[model samples]
Target: MELEGKVVVITGGSSGIGLATARMLLEKGATVVSWSRSRPKISHPDFYFFECDVRHEHSVWAAYEQTEERLRQNISVLINNAGLGIQGALDTMSPKDWLTMMDTNVNGIFYCTRLVLPGMKRMREGHIINVSSIAGIMGSENLTGYCASKFAVRGLSEALYKEVRDYGVKVTCLYPGSTDTGFFDNFEGVTSRENMMQPQDIAATIVHALQSPPNFHHVNIEVRPLMPKGPKSPKKA
Candidate 1:
């Protein structure tokens, strides 16, 4: 879809990949609406920030309602990027941590997608991008809850893609690996940022998917950093 003057709604747009995407889309002339628990730092004439918690259905609905009332436009794109992770072994992971990951990663996407589908169906054209993780594709040692939630996102995206394609709507599942974001701050395992992908790189990929020609669509994109060389040996020692 041509991005000019389009209405794009992004979840978790306060920072990181979502923030980068909002900036990029705005540069292409799209009006950007960001929904998050905290206010985004962006200030643009075409940018609207809505404080929302996507895990709650009512909050998500209210955000959409306000967007329509204020912008007077149906959303042309929906980016489900609000998610959190708590990495740990299954047995050691707290129940609260598990619920938090599931609610934020899986239920949040569901609520936001549910609210946007009706508008997209009415317009008969839209794009939905769900940000999953490499853990969604491959299981990891200490990230059971995180992996489960992401895997659910993958399944949900694929099923929704099949259901919505007939309505001229496209659904894409993005599996990004080891990006240089605060996502690692709460992680329980060791994390290395030696050769991590930048948030802008993922944002560019998302824009590319949205810019696909009318005749084609991208269903899934998996991105990862090249394997970093091992640290040099301590030969002097």
Candidate 2:
């Protein structure tokens, strides 16, 4: 679909991949409505901002309503990018942490998708991209809650893709390798802060998928950095 003049809504737009994507989409001539709980310094004429918590249904609904009121158009693209991570072994993690991860990573996608579908159905065209993670596809030692939540998101986005493809709505779940984002702020590890994908690279892939033709339903895409084949080297070359 052509992004020019399209109304696209992205969550977690204050920083990281979402903010980068919003900037790129705006450059491509799309009207961007970015939602974040915390505001950022934005200076784009075509970009609109909405402060929202995706975990809250009321906040999600209110943000969308405000988008419609401002743009006078149903959303052509919905990017569910808001997520948080908590790191700990399953036995060590608190119940509160698990619930928080589930609510934000899993249920938040459901809430936003449920709210956006009716509008897409009425319009008969839309794209939904769920930003999953490599953790969603693989298991890790200390990230039990985070892995579970992202895995559920991957499953939800896949199932929803099958259900919505014939309706002119495309659903894609992107599994990005760890990127330099606040996503690692909760984790403590040697490799957590480095040796991962870049947010701009992921954002470029998203724009490519969004612009793909309807005949190409390239649904689930997993992106990871290429690891060295040789023995441990001092530097990556």
- The models' CA-based lDDT, in order, is 0.91, 0.86
Candidate 1 residue pairs that clash:
none
Candidate 2, residue 154: Cα displacement in angstroms equals 1.1
Model 1: how far is 178 from its true place, Å? 0.4
**In angstroms, how far off is 186's CA in candidate 2?**
3.3
Clash statistics: count for each candidate: 0, 0
Instruction: Please provide, for model 2 over 1-237, each residue's C-alpha lDDT reduced to its tens digit, 9 standing for 90 to 100.
Output: 999999888888889999889888998999888878987557888899988998888998898788878888888899999999888899989999999999889888887889888888777789999999999999999989999999998889889988888888999999998687777775675463556667888899999999998778768999976651323658868
Error of 2 at 55 (Å): 1.1
Q: Taking the tens digit of each residue's C-alpha lDDT, what string does model 1 give over 1-237?
A: 899999999999998999999999999999999999988888899999888998888898889889989999889999999988887899999999999999899999998888888989999899999999999999998889999999999999999999999999999999999888888876664456767888999999999999998658899999988764435677885
Which model scores highest in lDDT? 1
**Model 1: CA > 4 A from native:** 188-191, 229-237
Clash pairs, candidate 2, are none
